[model samples]
Target: MILRVLLISLFLFFSLQSSAFSLEPVYSLQDCINIALKKNPEILASKATVNKSFFKIGEARSGYFPQIDLSLGYQRSYLENKIGEEYSKQYSAQMSLSQTLFDFGKTSKQVEIQQQFYKATEWQDRDTVLQTIYSVKESYYSMLKAKKQKETAQEVLKQAQRHLDLAKGFYEVGLKPKIEVTKAEVELSNAKLNLITAEKQLSQALLNLKVAMGAVDMPDFDIKDEDYAVRKLNENEAIQIAIERNPQLQAIKFNKQASISTKELVKKEYFPTFTGSASYGYLNEDFPLDKRWTVFFQMSLPLFSGWSTTYRLKQAESDIVYYSSKEDSLRQQITSQIKNLFVQLKEASQKIETLKIALKQAKENLDLAMGRYEVGIGSSIEVVDAIVLFEQTNTQYWQAIYDYNVTYAQIQKTVGWVE
Candidate 1:
């Protein structure tokens, strides 16, 4: 009895532990968006890039400090003709430091380059955040749509079951034909099959949303939304906003400025550089940096290196031109995308309204056909036609909503608010 009690207690303990850390049965789409932004792999990757950029800035700043080096070595040498050996081994140590007193602004330009690179990485991180948020939103809405579809299918199954029972009652009383009973059975069977399909699809959509939230082993959670529909975009306003506020454009502009810095660095190479170097050494006879103290100062000049420096400067100028072209091309592309998004947004609004009206018409048609069939005045063909039309309208509305959502995501992506 004690062992049994212990086992039960252990099981309860583990169950409670599991429940505490496991995914909750409830989550709002907003919660999912927050979780994805914090944990998504793309955001992690961008964070790493930002760290890398930080190290690069450090590398550029390292030049600001004077370089210092130390050396220690031993050597032995003999003369061709010697009186008691011309050379002898000795201990040595030396230290030298270098400072860039002047380099025609090369150091400053390099620092600027790294700073721009850091900004670019920050923009990339923001882009990743936007992308993760939008992706989660899309998946969240998809799951909501699937859940509703399953609910609708279940309702249809219940309706078909009711109709089937009504048909059997009528047949027993000799009020309905045999064909009507068969038709009702067939419809109930189809409805059951549709419910099964919808349930499977809904289950998969839920899993996808969980994956987006970075909760692969999460428990099942239902999607709840009062309405899933596209909000119309202000066509011209959106275009203007995209033009001014897009991060991609800002990123490209920063890149162009970095290119200009590169050109300035290259132009600086034409001028002379001045650096201060100092070395201190301790040396012995025929040895390097040994016992006796020594000190030296150095100032070096780059007389010429063929035409390499000139060609390199030209290359830098060419790069500036190249990046300028890419910037303009990207600008044109973003503009076109903004315009296209506006057009699609407008089109989707009209389609949704029209589909809503069509759905109402289809429902009326089904009701009329059912009433006729009940009075022995309607054909099986009419009933089937009504069913088909209603389902078609049902599927059309979901598809339209899906298309609208996808297009809106594309618009956000163009604006660099979505990756």
Candidate 2:
């Protein structure tokens, strides 16, 4: 009795563990977006670029503080004369400090340029995030669509098999022709083929979703069946939100500001600069022998630099104009995108309604035909045709559903909001 009880306990333990491991992981839309944003390599690379730009801010600020340097040197010299020859060794250590007394706001302008550039980089990172989120949504919805298609195919196959069996029964009893059995068998074969194709497509879609989420090697998983509804939204309001919050537009604005600061920085190069320096030194024949200190002040003016500075200033000014034009172009593009997606969303919603009605009619037609055949008043071809019509309408309805959800996701991305 004890041995039997121990075996039972071990079996129960293993069964529980197996059930735990076999549980299907289901991800919602938000879950997929979050995973892509957190783990996608492209998104991470863009983040690294933003960090590198942030470091430039510190580099630009370094010019505002005093600069210091220390150096050590050893020198050996031999002198020969008519009377005698002598050899001497000298060792020197020196420390120097230099401070910018004034530069007409040159360093400040440089710092401002770096700050603006960093802001642009930050916005670029946000844009990358938005793009990744959109991609995840696209893949997620596609996987859902494929799964639905596969389910529909399986249902159609089962119905076709039943019809083939019925046709065989009728022919064997001398109530139907052999051609009816052949037709039903052909239909069943077609349905089976479609189901096989749908299964392959579903597997491919699952792989695509995993790739989009950067979980390429993850175990087989499923997505939650979410019924996405179309929400009423004012088109003008959406455009306004896009203008205000779109990261690509914001990045462009920052780039223009940085260009202006760069022009100022370049123009400042024409003005004179003043610097003050002090140095303390020790010089000895062998060890510590003598100590000395020196101080100096210097001023420099760029009388000419082969016209390079002037060209640089012109280039900076041109960049400011270029970025401004780019901002305008981007605004136009964004507005057009919002309008187009809004129209598509509306169309998809309408299509879904139309397809739903057609699907209802198709089902009714299939039922009527089946009932007529059971009562010996209808032909088998009519029933098969009705079945095909019903399947087509059903597939169309699901396609419309997937299209609406995809368009909604794009609209959200265009407006620069995804949570």
Candidate 3:
């Protein structure tokens, strides 16, 4: 008896814990975007790349600082001469410092190259962030649309059930035939099937939202309903904004600048590098040691390197042309994308307005049909048709809204809008 009671108590405790764990958290659209920015692997990787590029700039500037090195050695030798055999031991330590006095602005140009590359990486990071935000918004709206579709299915099912009950009552009173009952039953079955499909779609949409948030392991959650205001953009203005703010375009421009700087730095390879060096050394065979010091200046010129320097200069020049061409191509693509998205946004807006009106009319027609049937003036077919029409129009209206929101997100992404 005592063991039985203990087992029951433990089961109850675990049941309570399970219930608490099963509760889902609700998040707004902005909350999902924030989470994605913080946790998305793509965004994290892009940020890491930006940091690495920034460090490269410091690495390039290191060429301007003096380099110091230390060395130590121990030696023992045995020798035989015409008179006798002898052995000697030696210990030595040396420290050396070298500084580049001049490289014809080579170091400065390298630093400039690295700086440009860093700027390009920063813009790339921004582009990743914007893309992630757009993904989150698109998924969020899709999930909302699915949820509304499920609700619509449920409502349709209720109407089908009501019609089934009315058909049975009219038949009992000898006002309707048995076929009417069969028709209502068939409609109810279809409604059930539709509701099941809608539920599955909603589940899939939620999973998609989770992936977009970069939190696939996150617990089940709900999203708050959001309404978007209609917005229209001027084609010329949108194109200008995309040109000015698009991260890809900016990154390409910086890359071109970096290539130009690299070419200039490469040209300096034909010139001589001027450097100064100083060294101090100690040597001894016993406890006390003799000290020696030396200082000197040197110049090194690349007289010939199998034309490697010349080839490198050519490569740098080619990179400049390649990036310049790439920049032109990207600008054209951006302009075209902006134009297409603008047209989509307009079309979605119009559909939303038109579908909303259609949805209202559908609802009114359904009401009229149901009222006429209640007054014994309408047939079962009329009522079922009205319900079906209402459901289709309602679904279309929600779809249009979803399309509008997604198009708006695409436009923002194309324009490089960040928040």
Candidate 4:
């Protein structure tokens, strides 16, 4: 009975393990980007900032509404007078309302400033999203590249095994020497080593992809291979698009507008502000209290504050200058980045085309060398050299493809083209 129970338990465990392994999820490039957008910490933080800034607009607009407050108090006092020592208890309740009559657009300017800040945060959030998407794409492409390289390594190992078998057969049949068999063995061992390295690299790439997607407890997963088509882009057009659509540039523009509004608000601080307030209250030492009411209007004028207002105005003006210069700097920086990325993308595209031809030629060379060696017309050295060349060309071709895809992603990010 004990043996039977142990056997059944082992079988069930293996079955469940197999089922779990077979159910691992496969994510596509788009799926990875979606995951990153939803889970990336930077994106979440930026979105929160955007939400916080939106509430600030409402806070600033609150100045347009009346302010109301209520107060209740109880106090006991002792006094010494000519009659003797006396104690008194007092209770009071009061409600008051205050409203700003006018202030030369000070409140309005404050609202405008907050609105501009809200716009800036919105753009900043967009920028963060774009950056996150780019990171996901980069990591996804790197993982794909590693996967392809691993496949290539496996193919080379197969080729090496075939060569070794052929060399052994030739040696046994007296068509080749023992040295040929030894060389083939060495080549096979090298192929196995390369495959091991490729597998390690692939595992590292997967870890990097998981990090980019902000996945903490992700199960083993696979990514589907994708075909990317190349597109032609003009540098001038790309630069123009980046200048118009870049989130950072848009944010800076809004920030500068907010600074200008702040300067306008400060200028109005020098003018007088008119306000009105009314209070109704009851006060008495006994249960039955007397009622009192008062209403008043007041004006506040800034006479002098050690030239602080003047300094504030100057500071606001300086902020405007700083932002203007910053805007210009960003434009130039974006233009330069666009130009550089375009150049890199073009080069990578060209390399893909070139390496495609090279890979084909290498395959033909490897096949011919193998055939010649089998017929005893070619040397083992020739075949080994051909194999190495084929593997190198194949790896380079895939690397070029990876570079093209990554560069294209960067260009999309720089131009604010999200998909």
Best by TM-score: 2
Greater-TM-score candidate between 2 and 4:
2
- lDDT string for model 2 (192-229, tens) is 99999999999999999888888898888889998767
List model 3 lDDT by residue over 77-104, tens digit each. Answer: 9999998999999999999999999999
Candidate lDDT values, in order: 0.76, 0.90, 0.92, 0.92
lDDT of 4 by residue, 1-419 (tens): 99999999999999999998788699999999999888888988898999999999899999999999999989999999999999999989999999999989999899899999999999999999998899889889999999998998998898889899999999999999999999999999999999999999999999988888888568768999988678878889989989999999999999999999999989999999999999999999977888999999999998989999999999999999999999999999999998888888999999999998999999999999999988889899999999999999988988888899998888888889988
Number of backbone-clashing residue pairs for each candidate, in the order shown? 7, 0, 0, 0
Segments in model 2 whose C-alpha atoms lie over 4 Å from true places: 1-20, 77-86, 371-376
Off by over 4 Å in 1: 1-24, 72-89, 226-233, 285-299, 357-384, 416-419
TM-score of each: 0.80, 0.92, 0.91, 0.92
Error of 3 at 43 (Å): 0.8
Instruction: Order the numbered candidates by TM-score, best leading.
Output: 2, 4, 3, 1
Model 3 backbone overlap count = 0
Clashes of 2: 0
